[model samples]
Target: MACLACLLALAFVAAEAQQMQSNISQGSSLTPTTNSTWLSRSGLYAFGFYRQGNGYAVGIFLAGIPEETVVWTANRDDPPFSNNATLRFTGDGLALPTAEGQNYLVKPSSTPSYASMLDSGNFVLYNSSREIVWQSFDHPTDTLLPGQRLLSGNELFSAKSEADHSTGIFRLKMQNDGNLVQYPVDTPDTRPYAFYSSSTSGAGENVTLNFGADGHLYLLNRNGTNIRNITEGGLPTDEGKLYLMRIDVGGIFRLYSHDLKKNANWSVQWESSNDKCDPKGLCGLNSYCVSIDLQPDCRCLPRFEYVNQGNQTSGCERNFVADACKNRNENFTYTMEELESTTWEDVSYMNLRLSDRNDCIQGCLEDCNCEAALFDGTNCRKQRLPLRYGRRDTGTSDRALIKVGVPRKPDTDPRIVQPGNKKKGRTGILIIGLSFTAFGSILLLISVIVWWKHNVWAYKRMSAVNGDLELNEGVALRRYAYEELEEMTNNFKEELGRGASSTVYKGLILGTQKPVAVKRLEKVAAEGETEFQTEIRVIGRTHHKNLVRLLGYCLDGAKKLLVYEYMSNGSLADVLFTRERQPFWEERMGIARNIARGFLYLHEECDAQIIHCDIKPQNILLDEFMCPKISDFGLAKLLKADQTRTTTGIRGTKGYVAPEWHRKMPITVKADVYSFGIVLLEIICCRRNVDWSLPEEEAILDELAYNNYHTSR
Candidate 1:
């Protein structure tokens, strides 16, 4: 009976495959209005006319996915009308009707015989001998699936969005100079700006970009010489995994992978650039881009607001009018706000060799067209009103001065004063008005005094109530003043470390004389302000031996500072990679277990489930007794009990990020588990997870471990 059942299943599978492989003859047509499609032999891909906006697009899509994932499109730039168009296969070739009622023919050699949608998602037209004449893979849309090759002169244009199937403003192509580049299509010239290129050296022509089945995006020369690994990482060995490279509408080139066996959705495995603010014209003009917890945010400069209040990318407009150059009002004084580490690279009005910072400021002040000035402690770059590509570069010592208008006092009432003499009738009226105003002013003063006293009393009452309630159950958090923190840190002289979000300084808390670490965050947009508040709230509410303790915080304007109990032994990264001495094996084991316990408390034991999105060595602090403590909750996410996963943009360092992050799959605590596994291997090997110093096969610890496990079995 079992043998008979197996035979019947085999027969059914063969029948389905044969049905999918049937060819489409000449004179036949496929139309979106008729819901016609040609399926591949494996039933994994289908070719048909898909609905795109108000028109119809001829493309190849996945067979069973809920959302349509189009791999190739024949006429992406010129989609046909929804109900009025047809894709007809004729002896002349495949023909589509243009908007002008003319036939747009895709002619192949020797009278094309038939067409087939292949299992690899390639739609091919074949001649009598079954030889390929033309293929859809030769002209791709925005996505490049595994085994697909992007040849020289071929470009992939990203779609506007998931809903809008129209071409977007970003393009990825191989230039004639032998460079694979991704740049904004809206830029003025073809010159690559804010783009990711394979290499700076012009190697040769006929360079090809390929997405391999092993999940690696490779750049190759005409002779098949490997020029560069655009995604330099280990490939997944599982045959069930699918890989694809896409240029997203945000001007980012991302490589994603999906696991068929686990039924997991696509995750981002690699990206060309991690800096969200690197995309040119991301905030349009006269606005700055900042990454608030790994997300891009745009904000207008001082004395400016969004031009279109509904859209930040529309740039900004001045709240106050500037002094006109033609009028040249000398009485118009300017106020300048210093923006640290900010830059306006290409939109400078003038570049001057200034001896001092004061000279740079004065130069900008004198120039009528100068709306802002940037100084790198040497040269001054004066920028006009519409400053483009304004971004914060923490690696530089650059400073920007944004010009603002000083509020002018209201003009004195002309009728209230007389230069020479006053008429007798007006004098009598003015006297009466003065008496009434004096009496009203006395009453207003008394009302103001009463309001001030009541406000003082209310403030005192609120303070007393707040002092009694703990931040959490046992932790008591203080609200320190910015000046007090500055005094404690000795003007931030004792620098400890720096990260993407903030800089740390060692300080001694007054009264108690206990050591503390002060983290002064870099200037961020409104989103970052919310992240700061989350970190404070999360850290303040939790108390655990394995977690870093939050002592207090300072919320001064532009200066967000967090105080924490100092770790005497520094970070685990310092002991593991920087120092020459290797930690004892037992200590390593203990640290690993402690880190796991910390994650346990965060994920399961906390009042609310907290996921530390970024879990790495630098965030793992060690005390004098060598006890491990998890720090840096800036990228943490809190979830409810019923929710098993949440959606978020890619976070965490590259090597430490889990496969789920890039796949666009729902993120769960499993992400931290994957990172923890990598950390464990690194601890045991006493090396970094992705150390290029090692041999190619052993460079990635996780891959090495997987290989060894399978080999041993």
Candidate 2:
């Protein structure tokens, strides 16, 4: 009788525990079919299938929230198919692979059999007694809802271009030193320390300070004492809405609070970085970043001018467009201001008393592959570190050193001359007199001091930096200073527009000594910083005359801007929509050809797979030569060269977006081809894709634009 009662008690306790499941069975495969969706108990999240260009995948969504926000995903970089995919709760976690039988460890199938959404908002796969096996909190996309910790252990990555689900060049995670920083994958060795945080005041071990209550998030010392509150929710506008913050895949860390007033749309309270050029490598190679207008935040780096800068994700290419090896002379380089960042390189540190600039240069001139050299106008330096060089996270402007090859040795150091033997006799007498004046004592003291300082500095740098050269002189770009940008924009006068994350303005570039356009981006969280840097690097490498030129970029704390050349005419959209702005037939074809070439370069020639999610004529720009230039890469994507396709959320304007776009699909180079065909039809008919003015039967492009649309099929 007692044994029976014990069994009953065990069953009762199991039944009392709250259970959260998306489908038919626990520890069994869940195949989503025939128009189905799964939701959590509190209705805080959901998981199911979605369709896109030509494929499908098992995906996630937030429940109860109006915004179809996706947090943790089963098939992000590569999604499952539309026909018969299964989101199975296996012995380990959840396995939602493609019906075609492709494999991925979305949630490794091991130990934890159950997945649940905790009241704290963290969604995880749990074991029998509730130990976490896998959790959505580990991997983040664009947003971090409340109850989720932004900075945890060691996993972070940039979201694919606002649309795609493939991995990107940017990454956000913890550093060995325990501070938060952003990194660009391509420039990993450089270790550019764009930002840094510490738990303690100045000398203690660093610790992450996260959100605790209703308002702020801070970074305090290891002791939890000296708090550095980085975010705050002030004013009545943010009241009532709970705020959650995290770094996004786009290289931004933003504070999100659902707007109770407008369908609960998310609002940004603050961010850690900005999105001017989209990132450090926006254009590709051999280019500079420039702001298109006078906007401070909307500027680029130097050596570039804007040709086709429209909308959010863009930067400038090179002005000359030097042909490969053909116009080798055209690849001349301009100096860039060293920044406090890391690039991959081994470094060593040395100290020297104040000296002349020439002496410093002479010191660094002794290397062969010395990519660069810098000095603080006194001490000389040479760094073997590759990829990049700059100051540390504290915004150092003090010293500079460089590693450069022999500077041809101006006339062999100028041999020293001396009077003949007559002077030699007098010299010998003078030397003997000075010997008694305590010269030996002075020399001994100087040697001892030098020895002690060198050892001390060597040990210090080993701990603080990889290695160190002298921080004396450094390369400086002609880019405008933060103050100069403010003055140029008349403090940001003409406002062109505003969007989900940034604002636009007009400004002038300083080094080029020309007028340009600028965009001032609002601050982002840690997630967006890597993308921002990458965009800059891409733009810096690309060189094309017709392409928008990147003049320069500025990263002063939260104030980030990109500079670009000004285009007299607006976007291709303006030209197409307004009769007066429309170009002639020849011009239209030229625009098409130009855009195609740009796409070809991105898709075929770029180091990675490039896809333009939002491709439209409006993004095309015409230069003084009337040459068309493709612009606006905010939606541009980079894929692993081997992959056939990637996953992403739905983006782009209506009608123009592909049919499979609304759901998960294999977005191919054909996707861009499809949009181009539509643009061609618009050029042919001289009308919009969807027009109410036309007879209902004739408007949907189904009746008139078949020639181009069906051409591909």
Candidate 3:
């Protein structure tokens, strides 16, 4: 009878605990000061506002634990709100109505009837049928809780600092190819650039990163098979204990655990890397990161000083003039400062295999253009200014020799003038020096006047001939002579592609083996000069990742050419039409987005508006990584700051031209949008706009797509 009574009491307690899981009504709300949380049934997690910076930010936190820990934040980059802010669970979803605007914490796909904060650290919203419409687990900030998964292509950005929850300098990306890599924010996601990776590239599709309740952090494949274990499972899962994985401010991905019973600070259980200096760009350009007592510190290279005294990561600058190479002479003195156990990104423009170390050093010293040299005992590589990705590694055999100017010493010899007669000779020398200086100054003034007049005349004549053809030195836009283009292109023998206005030929940069695309204007005598001027004016000033870089131009008596960074993968047309195996769906989607971003930068984000009069698959070139770069600015129309539209001739390919161009109407940026829409349709179907091979109804891609959509509806 005693055991029966005890079981009955335990059953009653379990039933009571199950009933405690409460649903938040649609009209329920929360604030920073009053009614600040809607907590889980176990009171372990809360969804509400928390202190961030000077104000409060909406996020989910540990409500039951003695130490408040924030796991997820809404719009992590958005500014904080004042006390007047209210987070309401309304019909639209979880909304935060502030003085600025009505922000949604989680935008639901369907109308939400109620919300709930689960003990599993997930804040969820549901429809009338109790089906989940949205959840906080889908969009995580810096931390990942147990039962959470980071799907492929998703990223976790570290907080700016311990106190600030804003996006920081590091990013943890779950790449599409089933690799988890960490990189510095704003850098490319290439493998060579990553500081840390899971080395699980061939893992099957639908791979997800998971942090188990037992503190096992791992990657799971599509069939629920474990691909790799980041951390072995070995942690207590007792009551009042919690675990979370977060990318810390110092660019380290760490897993931490906290015990509510102890009421102490969180303890680190596992970290991705042990080296503090593993992250690239910890020190910016012209500087290197060194490890001192396991702590990372940035130091400038020899003869260089920190750009910012307090912030060493801001990089270094040469203390002396950097133009020694440009004004070099036989008598100029240079010293090669050797840095041992150092390695940097080797972007050498020239390399030579010498017999000995002295020959390597002497070779660099003789070359006026060599600013620095790398010697690996047998090979010597010459480099230019602003070296990058420098770090100290004791294992490296390569040594860096930085070339710095040695200032000339003054010629002071007491033996030349006897001590007794020095004072008497000084007066005579001073008088003679003053007379010579006055005479030289007058001659210099006359020469300057003559030079100024001649330069003014030449400037006017060149301006008239070139017609405002100026390149920005900041972009390294050079002007190549016709003979130089001939040498780089090997006498224009290998043609890559041909358009109505120009023909692209493969070329190699003179000193470096880097490839370039040399586009020569075919009709320069008639209207090619107009196209050349337009390209220089527009592409020279614009700098973007999606846009093809304009390296230089050539205009030597109507031999017009434009040099560009070569596209290895060729044009989008080649990928869509020529290849037997189609591009992956995700790759197609990425290409579309790249094109859209490039157009956005051109039309909306540029200082002056530009309309790519031609928008077609042929015009969208792909780089080595298959990243789309918008090219061929010969037909681009540039607009002034105040101008919204312009009148021009119909200037695009046959099917891709906008309707407004043929209607004789003034065209706006919307014209480009129309052309982009057509190209986008082609990308979706992976076909040409007008394909004669297709059946009668599907001959025109855009019309067929519209008809199919209406028919399906």
Candidate 4:
């Protein structure tokens, strides 16, 4: 009887182990119950045990893919001895043990643990207190997924050789001496390659890498001190490891299998690096590095020549110094006919205006201690440290001059003022004003001429040929066939922007071989004729430079399209809320002023007052000159000439929509004011109105507005 009871218990345990989440456990346990579909948690990943190579292992796979593609492994190196394996996640983390016994494979740690699959596709193992104890990232057998980072410390960890899972020769870790190095692990140290470094010197001071929000990848590296193009394309995908690029124990780096359409297929961007030879004064000593390139676009920076010339590791120095400061009059400045490129240290940062070059040189001469004076644009920057020399790779850097000695006072006399000053000054003033006025008039005249030639005349001629539509007003618009639009957009190359009522595209105008933006209603509810006619009747009659110019539009039975002048610089929302560069503080504030000025023009300056019901950043476009242009008139309301305000439907973006509008209060200019305030705050912090990612302090727009206003004041 006792033997039968033991047998029954064994059977129960064996049956339970077959469907466990993973064949491994740290400290917790997960039963393989179908109570929830594999799409259990974040929908990004799933957990299960796989029977492969006659061995069973535990791993995570993409939940969104049609095929089960495993991305992370729990027991990658060691599979369970039997098919009866189970995984558990407890207070300590995770433990993988065979149901038969713990000895065969029990990753039991003394600490508590918890295991979870992250949205980034990494299965993390944390200790009792939830601190990461071990992660799939460090043990990447052969894959680099988005959000996974290879820790480049003082060692280059490598993967197995190509075509095999066994260890290989490639290494990607920091060198023993503290430099970041990526080398073939099995290869002798005699021939290790460097992709980039923190150290750089003269003309070789160029290198950068940018990953677009949409997964576009580019590499800018340095050839000695100059920038060199590195990559022709972004990371590639292979097999099921679609998102990660993994370097296995084999010498070859492979893209692990992944599904391109799955969220797991996100592209990850790597941080940029600079070799020590790209920056000026990187070594801190009195020398610089000069580097040159090799074939196939390879290069190195210049090092100390005689003592060690042209070697990037050792910087170069001067054998001569100018006459002593005491004999200041005999001192002369010399141009190195070279650039200093080295990591910065003991340096004085300055900004010099180009117009102040003469003054800057004289200032360096006047002060023996002024080691360097830079003049770029209209500003001047003077560096007072002895370590001052050369240019910077940073875009904000200015042109500069290095001085070796002190300057002296002028030996000339002053003269008296002339009696003809008033007449001369008046004549100069007249000439300047007349010149400016004439220039403005000419510009206006050219704009009128261009408008008439391309739009008005073309409209007249095309009207004679095609009778699709005609405008009563003289607002000349170019007509385009569907094929022309299709060609211009590369077949609707993803909507560049979308508003509450319309979607905008980055495309070209078929007539003039010029690029232009096109706006068409969404394919959703906009299918109705009522929605179509309402938008056309209102926006077609409007004309203002600050407003987006209405090129020609299409009104096919099922299709509704409107063409507008292409603003090379896109929308304000992209600048203020998306991943694009944030406009300068001055520019943002100026945009605020421009919006206000634009609103004033729409409400008061136009022949007919138009109430822009929607005044969000998405509806404002930045022109070539970075000027603000109001757009999306589908929600605009024309006010009576005598009426200052009007009652309107609840419209515009939710966060920016005025509180009164929801209560059906009359829409006043103040509603636009409230919305403008939100847009202004969005510009200042470069975030959306209700973004939860922002800290609690900056999350609330009203508070930010008040604080920013007070701070600016």
Candidate 5:
């Protein structure tokens, strides 16, 4: 009986395999009106017309799955067609001929004799020689099936949302440098703009990001060597299980698994990062990001109002005018509004080293250009208009002083002066009234003409850039020309650091002579022009004491540059690893708190959730006061408002990577928390996370801490 059962099972497997390879002739076609489809041999996948928007779109979907999930879409950005349209496989390739025109979803290099929808979720067009002329896998929209590879220079863009299959804001690219990177759509493809990366550069060129049949997602080099394993482990090898890697709607790369006989639902097997705020530029200018119960929330600073109340990310604007220099004896009285435990962009034009807080306040009150003041105990730094990156933090000792105008009291005396001659007064009053009426009419006419011209000019400007370079009305970023940047940086003379994606240079503000850091991005992905400006606006809007401030940006054709306030004390790594004297215990504890608070602001306080995937001493910079400011957003990750877990290629420096990054599990904010814990341990030890020079047992800081804890217990 056992031998007979084994024979039957073998026969069944052979029959299913035969059924999975069906061929379609050139005349084959599908129509949406009849809900027609071409199914694979096992009926697990299908290629057909699916309902989209008000019409229909041609795509491939999972037929065996109850939910009918779409894995690949052709011409995803094209508007849906009516039922009258027919998708036909012909000598001219796969064309969807509509009343408007002939839309070829795939134009084969050679004429195809037949087409097939393979069980592996791939749709192919074959030439007369039986060689593939075109395949769906070659032009992937978002998902990668088992046995498929995302080739070098290829990218997978997420859907607009779960309900919409249109291209979204996030993208995952298999770079030619053997690195897999994730970035916001339309942003520059530079290291500083990336949210996640495989960090597999120099592993050899033409590296392919692959998903194996055994459910292992990894990178493979041109030499056929497995360069990097994205997931630490693979799923249990079973015939009934299927897997796919997709860049999800929440701007995260994720691996999903499904069981045919079990629950019959797709479950998250692995994720990239959990914190949604990890992606920079989540909010508009003059605003900071915070998370409320894991949801992103944007809040305006003190005395500032939202530019668009309905869209909180649109940023904020000052509610009161700054007329401090109008006249000292004028009725407008200026007062300092104190904000405790707050910090912002340190772009102070004037700095007064005063020991007393009262003197700082008095100095700001006396200066006409001082819109805000930052007092860090010993130094009072006076800031000008358009304060950026302002956020509340309990870790920093910096306090903010905002200059506000006080309302003047109405005059107590109401009595009017009596005229000397009644007839003379009446005649004078009549003459004055006629003259006033004439002047008011002329003023109204001038105002109307000015409004018309302003609107016209704005419309022309919007049209000129095709609305791609325009920022939100609340954004107050200075648009510097290429010439201005050249002058500021002294023709790019002083080099700071040259990273993989950008080169930093020390520069001075033109007239102010204020020191600044200029970052010149090496590459720009102009495919998403509108998205680039949108992300720039988001970066401009974010204001936090613990996060680095983006003072301005310049988009001069192919040259992309970012301006930031200079950090006088350099990076925390320099202070920790290079210096002979380590920070005091109290100072280390304070630094840890500041780092945690900065992450809190990024994760919980901002409207856009952010996760700093690479949290290390080198990425943390110190201000003049030795306060830690989080920098380097190259490996950050973002999540949607309702999302808390995401999957993607492994990111971060090796020693600081979280265990979940190696484990086959969905990563959340806990991953960042784990990295933070390791950082804390490093701070306590005043050493690197890994040091081979030390004894084997004490080489790894986290491992050492674990052993010490257990031994003490």
Candidate 6:
């Protein structure tokens, strides 16, 4: 009897929980002027007509928050309506009457008995049988909730701004062709031009994009099979953590997570794309976007001003119109303004037969429609007005020619003094002169202090290396200050690779725009100082096509950095092991030969006899043309011509270190030869010598090579 009573009590609780209370009856209505809302049973979500500017929008908002957070908005792209707006639930469906007196039905197909605001923030209309006819989840605005399916027919459109609930320029859509694409709203066609896409082509039919409860956004097939994990490595595991995938105002699709215990606000975990300039319509037409300190800044071309001074996306317009072709005036002559590394991709253009840079400029001048001409050495591409996707590239050698009118002198001074105010003007001039003198003195003092501090720092750094060290003349290598190196590397933002001794970063020299690889060494001890000095001495003077050149070094207090010519292809290990495609047989043979030639130069051609104790694949860097250059001479030891070997501790990497190193015997140049032979075998076999993935018998490359040699004999 007791068990029966307990089961009855549990059943009652479950029944009560499943039942939902209707926020609006079958014949009820809501008006915009009333500022009325229908709250969910849990009191977490509400359905209402919210005011935006002078108009109103019917949307779902998180009512529990201090500030109204609208998760979904209907009629985002439609023009806002005034106080006459009404949302009425009828026998047919839910009808939204606009200020124009036209009624738009929410779900016109089925008869809805009532409307309810669910805890999930979905506003739904249910029939007599309690089947969902329509819901807000199917038509999301900018944000995606967990368990919501962004279907093929639906799209997530970002809002213009935080204050404005109007449709923004950016949108994310699940295309009919199985690819998920994010594009600017103003894009003419469905196909992506500059937009970001999932690139999962040919998987479109019956596909659903879902934001999972585990904080992963997934693209699923009809049978609920995960086609792709969009947020591959950034899924949140903790329960009750709020996660949202939103297409932000900048057109960036970002996955954000919020944990009340850990953070006060939401933190971005992943984004669709990191290149801010790739998005189309970022800055309006006639303007170019440049990353200033990693932030996007828009600038207009010559002879143009911002269309709207407050908004950069409004683009730019010409201050003066071009001269008429029929009546060409002498005062309206064209001047070419060079814009380097700019490309207007996919914009229709007329190809010019002219090859010379000046000829291309003249060609653009001849055509009335041509706003600019781009010359990329081989071809001349002339573009039309309202240029889009204008960006500056530091890597390429393309240039844009924009024709501007001849310079004109101003008619009169905007600032003028009356004829009777000569005495007052003189007094003002004296005050201005005093202010200028004071400003100049302050600037001069600051420069002197900076110069003096730099000298003191440089003196201390030089003293640490050598007491009588002079970098004034004769030496080919330059000594750079730590701060200069930091600036060059952009505070070491892009790390190429890291080893046990140091980390390498890609950097550009300020004035020359020369790319360099800056290797920042670990804090120096007495032994490390010796190695640093040895590297500077050996690689500094030794110049060869097969050896990496040391361009400069930095030694300020504890900071030690070595700058070398940037290797575009990176280390041999990266190509052989990390990359997906293996180098061709011809390329492999050439690389092996280059390594041998580098060794020959180090051993015989150089002024000093140097033995590179560590000659592994990691130290061999490849140039832009895939030519191998031997690098990392920190383990190198200098010896006399007669001296063949020297006593030393073990230094080279495992598996490549010579047998003599293990035997506590004197190290010789043969140690490099041993390591080189190992590299050659690994390159040929396309496998590491000591790889555990292989059978124990065939693991060591050197041993296998020896066995093959014996068998052949």
Q: Pick the TM-score winner.
A: 3
TM-score of 6: 0.52
* Clash pairs for candidate 6: 178-204
Whole-model Cα lDDT per candidate?
Answer: 0.72, 0.49, 0.77, 0.49, 0.72, 0.71
Per-residue C-alpha lDDT of model 5 across residues 502-617, encoded as one tens digit per residue: 78899999645999988887757753343345445544544567787777788888888888888887788888886674777667667766776677556654444667788888
lDDT of 5 at 77: 88
Work out candidate 6's RMSD over C-alphas.
26.1
Better of 4 and 5 by TM-score: 5
Candidate 5 deviant stretches above 4 angstroms: 1-22, 282-288, 298-713
lDDT for model 5: 0.72
- Using lDDT as the measure, name the better of candidate 1 and candidate 6: 1
Clashes of each: 6, 156, 0, 101, 30, 1
**What is the per-residue lDDT of model 3 for residues 213-247, given as tens digits with 9 covering 90 to 100?**
98999999888899899999779998767899999
Q: Where does candidate 6 stray beyond 4 Å? A: 1-23, 31-35, 81-86, 96-102, 188-192, 233-239, 260-263, 353-355, 407-713
Give RMSD to native, each candidate.
30.8, 29.8, 22.0, 24.2, 27.6, 26.1
lDDT score at residue 172, model 2, on the 0-100 scale: 53
Give residue 374's error in model 3 in angstroms: 3.4
lDDT tens digits, residues 361-473, model 1? 76666555567888888667766567777787788789888878654346733343121112222111011121223234224323332343233212111011112212232
Task: Provide the global lDDT of candidate 4 against the true structure.
Answer: 0.49
Write model 2 residue lDDT over 1-713, tens digit each, in one string: 99999999998867533234432236555354553445566545555565533566555665556666555555466644556666666664565555466364455435775666543455567677767666666666544555444443354555665555555556555443445565554333123334333333333344544565464666545576635566654535343454566556545667776754566687777777654333444332322233355222333223344445662234434443322222222222222233222221223222233366545444333222232344544444444322222212223234444321122234533232211101111111011111222233224323332343233212111011112211121212124457777866779998755544456577755433467767666746663454345445444333344456555566787777766666667566667778877777566656655655565555544334456666666656666656666655555555664554677776556677776676678675556655655665565445777888888766876344343333434
Q: Write the per-residue lDDT of candidate 4 for residues 97-146, one digit (tens) a residue.
A: 45554432224344535455555666665565767666665555445555
Candidate 2 TM-score to native:
0.40
